[model samples]
Target: MSSSPQPEAELAKLRFTLEAANAAMWDIDLVANTVVWSENAEQVLGLRPGALSTTFVAEPEWIHPEDRAGTLTALWEAARGGETYVIEHRIVTADGETRWVTARGGAVLDDDGSPARVVGVLVDITDRQLLAERLRGELAAKDRFLTTIGHELRTPLTAILGFSAELHDRLSDEELAPVRDIAQIITQQADQMVALIDDLLVAGRDADSPVPIDPHQVELCGTVRRVIDGWPDEHRGSVSIDEGPVRAFADPIRLRQIVRNLIDNAIRYGGPTITVRCWETPIEGRSHLVVIDDGPGIPSTPPEPDTGVHPTGIGLAVSRRLAERMGGSLSYEHVDGTTRFELELPLEA
Candidate 1:
């Protein structure tokens, strides 16, 4: 009959299994300050596989200086306090290459119930750590590039707005009626362009909320009419509004911004006609503004900007944020083949 497999053979089989997993096993003697390693452990520790004592005199030196104290403390806690630990840290190889390693270990108790030894496994995680660092570096570089581009765009934009405002003022003084209309158009378009740049910079910030809004009691009908009238002459006839002196607690600037963005989107993306409506839901007693268009519906787009991007949904996102900052909410619904957007605000008492 074949003899039962010896413990030594079983141990060798276990070590082979560990080697197959790309892991190295270690057994540390608490009393002798020495360690026994699986055959493959030396390569994992960045050491040449050679005959050496069970003691690892240079092992502490291999650990990163910043991590050495913490590593020793963790080992002591596991060996003395019967705790288990998993640590990821850097180790210097024989050739001075830094590698990240993850170690998981527990202590074995002696017959007297005192800590006798610690056994552990080590794995190289250098590739994973390196990949994480690379991604973070790439993200940081992208943010810096966006900030620089925003600043560059703002320089020429500031000059354009200033000159347009000056020309608009001068045209009012002269009786050049035809050129006055053109000057007014340039000033209006310039103002809208500045709002777009402001939206870009504000929305691109790395923060939970980017819009800074101050809420006040705003008369709604006049504001809404003025905004609708400001639209291009061609699209003005396409929009209809319900005339009422409805009041809302909202930031005036943000309110106009939100209105313009919504109107702009409807004209750009909607079907033939659009309607603006408002009413107060007195159940909980609140005022809400509604804008509906015969558009297909609001569609989700890729978050990243593409070249030659339009202002349709781009400004819509920041409009929602500005509404929220003023203690209001912006919501969208598509019903009966019409796309509807509503801005709900607290009623100013």
Candidate 2:
């Protein structure tokens, strides 16, 4: 058999290899209260190796003031339990730059099985911490942007609707004909703006919690009729609704907004006649509210604002957003030269 190596010589080799590694290494003698740290510790803790007589002296002193208490508490708990210490916290470097670090360590036992020393390793995690913070900031900015757009759009829309109503009330029959047409156009555009604002608000809210609305128990048919009645008789396209009272549990106002947007978009971009069909079907233990429109279909390519000319408006985008907020979906396809827009909402129980 080969001769066994001396224990002291073998330990020295292991220590040398650990010191050469990049990670910060440390040891604390519990009885003597003395501490030893590798040269790499300076890079992690901003302190020279062996700078302080005791590890506790070097702690709180170099650690970020805000993190000192929590870090000490965790470290002390691990030490008392005779277990490894593992923690991540912010630290101030030698040059006064803040960074994040992860530390892992364990207790060393004496011959009597009592805790004698604690040793550990540390790794820098500053880059990963910064990246997480950046993502959170970006999400907050998006929410603020949506809220601002809704507020701004609502102001102009309210003014347009109020003024149009006033004009409709004051004009004489002969004078009212032309004024009524102008008022109708204003009202239509105002309604479109309102729908857009509602979509933004609902999308922001739904980002937090989503709940399904019942479409079979709500008054959807009445809401559709009211929207059609608001349109001007001359300029309004011929609208037909199949007979029957359709009920859905969705927000009545939001449902009306979706239908109004689809119908308005059809008239603006497609033909003069707009047909709305409401029907319910059971699929996999759930009822669905289907609204189909025969209009110019959505282009396979995504809609662009400055496309010069197209048979689609932003209303489709708003409708899709509203449908999703109510836990439904909107889809479009073309069949036999007719562009069809479909809104599917969950039917009431």
* Top candidate, metric lDDT: 1
The TM-score, computed over Cα atoms with residue i paired to residue i, of candidate 1 is 0.56
Estimate, for each residue in 1-349, the C-alpha lDDT of model 1 and write its tens digit: 9999999999889888877777888888888879988888777778766643588564477788888888878888988997789999888877888999998999999899999899898898998999989977776676677678877887887787678667766776556766867866776677677678767765664443244567888866567788877555777898888887777888888898788888887877788888888777666557888888888876655455653233444587787777777777899888898988898887774
Residue-level error in angstroms, candidate 1, position 124:
1.6
After superposition on all CA atoms, how large is the RMSD of candidate 2? 8.4
Give each model's whole-structure lDDT.
0.78, 0.69
TM-scores for all candidates: the values are 0.56, 0.57
Model 2, range 1-349, lDDT digits (tens) per residue?
A: 9889999888677666655554577788988887887655775566655554544464656678998898877777777888877789887866778888888888888998888888888777787899978876776776777778888888878998999878866765885689877886788778767876775565454443332344435766567778888677753447666668755557777787787777766665566666677766655322243444455556656556553223345556666766776767888777776767777776754
Query: Model 2 segments beyond 4 Å from truth?
Result: 1-125, 138-142, 145-149, 199-217, 234-237, 282-296, 303-311
Q: After superposition, how far is residue 29 of candidate 2 from its true place, in Å?
A: 21
